[model samples]
Target: MHTIFGAGGAVADQLLPILLHSQQKVRLVSRTAKAIPGVESVAADATNYTQTLQAIKGSSVVYLLLGLPYDIRIWRAQWPVIMTNVINACKETGARLIFFDNVYMYGKVNGWMTEETAFNPCSKKGEVRAAIANQLLQEIKAGNLQAMIARCADFYGPIGFKTSVPNLLVIQNLIKGKKAQWLGSADQPHSITYVPDAARALYLLANKPEAFGQTWHLPTASELITGRQFAKEAAAVMQKPDGVSAIPGWMLSLIGLFNRPLKELKEMNYQSDSPYLFSSDKFNKAFGFTPTSYSDGIKETCLWAMESGK
Candidate 1:
């Protein structure tokens, strides 16, 4: 059985239904104790060593799906505790860990970032991520435990919440019958990973012995959508009211100075404003995993957002 942390979060919500259908026994852990039909639920603090160790014991694989709150300051307070606990838990139980991660560690990369991208984190959060990930990799290399990493790009899913860039900004516009807002230079090429595909990629890697001790980029639908084109497609999907305006990067950066979260996004202007892509050729050749098309995924997300009354 596998233990999925952050079970109440968006990614887990998207994953559980599919995972349950696969007939794999799962233990869901969250800050709040809630029941998922046909799955065990455990409420525990991820940063609490004893709680984490207790929850992790006897589980063959653990999904390190924990995410920090939106507050940058809180991340500083929390990530170390969580990583220390995770490392200790893995060491004690000899369980393999699959870390759910983002592309932040490959900070300021100029082209399609692959699994081989160097860790040159530029943001505070990126540094924390690099530290934790490298520490995990070191532990694995030391033969203390087994580990794998899956890095994803922007994401959207059915039970859409505040996790993805589009869901955070675009859904309101679609729902409000207004033109959606795009945060950066739309002309910059962007790759958005559907949340289901990200979850699937993580799950597929769980039992693959060859997958251990390395990192893999989640296969994502490749779309060369500039922020403008993406906004156009999203607007079409919702058929929203016209008069959409592009929110410029300078404005976002200006607002970032007052808002810590927005400020964190300033460093990522390179990604949101530049020609960035992700190459999944290696993963495809290795695992034969093909990502769902962006159009299909976007259409599904549209129907879901519209249905959710968001």
Candidate 2:
């Protein structure tokens, strides 16, 4: 049996069909049950050890795909506790763990980032991520659990309605025939991972024993594109005439004064202000999987956004 914790989010939502198609016995655990056919949905809070243990019982593999809100205070208070509970539950249940992670732990980097890059978290949220990731690794080393970390860049694909960049700014704006907003530097090259590709890669990694106890960057498209380029391509795909414009940091800060999420975003502005590239060469070499090109990804994303908007 394979169990997915925090299964209501975009990544888990994308992963569900893939697992179902394989005829795997899958359990989806979250605060509320999701109404998907051919899967068992269990409502449980992962921060509670007893509930997590009950949710993960009889599972061969457990996916840690939980996501917290964009508040630093909540992250600081909840991440470690949730991680500890999950780790303990996995250890007790003898379920192998696969953690879905992002690139925030690496902080700002010069040139492309790889799995081997050092952790130099710049913000409080980044520090929380780094700490939790390191704790997972320590547990693995201590022979308490078998696990792998599958990390991805900022992602956008089908069913990604709440994704940060593409959904909120690019695809939505283009679908509405409005000018797209770009965060920070619109010209800096940024890496993005297609959600479906990430789902496929995570499934593959879970089945491979050799991938255990290691961190792997998921397959991302090889070519890097700037936000302006992405928006332009998306606009063309959606047949919109409006162009993309950058949202200055000062403007974001002014908006942040009243909006908590926007205020929290200011600490991570360094990522958008400079070029951020993520490398998945190791994953490609191991699995021989190529990611969907940005053009194709954008086209599919636009279609999903248009359909969902209806």
Candidate 3:
């Protein structure tokens, strides 16, 4: 049986049926247990070693998909501790660990980022991510157990929120018929991953033994569409007038005094307004995996927004 942490999140929720379809025995562990078909849910916390050990027992492969609080200060205190718990749990159970990560470890890089990109993080959040990644990598390097890390770009899909572009601005603004505000220049290139793409890449990594001790870029669409272009496209999908727009850095900072989420998002505004292209050639060449079409992902998101009761 495969053990997964953070099953309450959107990615896990979407991945549940897909993993079960393969007839693989699955255990879904989170702090809260909810009913999902074909998978067993357990209420367990990753931060607690005793609870984690119980949740992960008898599972051959364990997936770390946990997240910290939105506050950077809180994250700095929590992420490393969480990683320590996960590492110890793996050591106790001898389970292979698969970590779901993001591009933060690479920080800000010029040109496109590929599998070969090195870590040179700038922001506080990026540094924390780097620490967590190295902890898991070290375990593999030591031959204590097997490990694989999957890095994905900012992805969106149904039930996604808190930091999702569509949930944060696109849909909410469109519903109110108010212009949406964003962090950076709309003209910069940004490659977005569909949530399904993220889940599938992790699945491939778990199934393939060769993936251990190596990092893999999750599947992302080939296109590097700009923020403004995405906005216009979303409008087309929603059949709404152009309601997307940009919010300057100073305003974000000013609003940050009252809004913690926007404040946390402000540090990385440079990437949103600059080119943040992620290359997936490594994953495609390795697992023959290609990402879902971007238009289809966006179309579904728009439909979710339209039908949502608010």
Candidate 4:
């Protein structure tokens, strides 16, 4: 049985169908009950030890895909507690764990980031991410738990329309026949992970016993493109006139004064302020998997935006 602890998240939502297609008995656990046909649903807040343990009971494998609110205070206060609760619960239940993570802990990298990159977090949020990730890594090193960290680069996909930066600023704008906005520098190349590929690679990693007790970067397209190039390609796919406006870091910071989300985004501007090249060659070679090309991914994303009216 496979249980997803933070069910209803973008990644967990994408992963559910894949697990079901493979004939796995699934349980969804979250703060609120989400009723999915034929799947067991448990309402539990992960920050509470008893609730977390009860929600994870009887699971053969557990996927920690929690996405907390994007606020520094919230992250700093809740992240560690949630990680501790989940780790202890999984340890007691003897369930193999898979943690879905992001690249924030690496901070600003001068080159392409591989699994071997050391944690040197820059932002308050990055520090919080680094701490929780290390909490899990220490257990792996001590051989106290069976687990692995599956990390991904900045993601863009059809489902996470609201939270995805590219979707909110670029794709959705292009779909609406308005000039798209690019955050940070438009010339700096950035690597983005496609949502479907992330889900597929995550499932593959969980099934492989050898993948446990280590960190693996999920499969992402090898090609790196600048924000300007991405907007151009997306415009071409949508057959819309190409035009994009770039949002500098200072401007984002200035706007953050009035908007809470933008204020939270101020610290993460480093990601788009310069090149963010991510390498997944380790997972690609290990699983013999390839990621979806940006051209195709953009086309599909554009189609989804049009169809869903998002």
Candidate 1 lDDT at 72 equals 62
TM-score of each: 0.94, 0.98, 0.95, 0.98
Please list the residue runs of candidate 3 whose C-alpha ends up more than 4 Å from where it truly belongs after superposition: none
**Over 4 Å off in model 4, which ranges?**
none
Question: How does model 4 score by TM-score?
Answer: 0.98
Better of 1 and 3 by lDDT: 3
9-71: candidate 4 lDDT, tens digit per residue: 888889999999999999999999979997999999998999999999999889998988889
Runs in model 2 lying further than 4 Å from the true structure: none
lDDT of 1: 0.80
Model 2 error, position 282 (Å): 0.7
- RMSD of every prediction: 1.8, 1.0, 1.6, 1.0
Candidate 2 — worst ten consecutive residues by lDDT sum? 159-168
Off by over 4 Å in 1: 241-244, 253-260
Better of 2 and 4 by lDDT: 4
Better of 1 and 2 by lDDT: 2
Candidate 1, residues 90-186, lDDT tens digits: the string is 8899888988888878888887899999999877778878988888888888988888888888777675657787776776677777667766665
Would you list the rank order by lDDT, best first? Answer: 4, 2, 3, 1
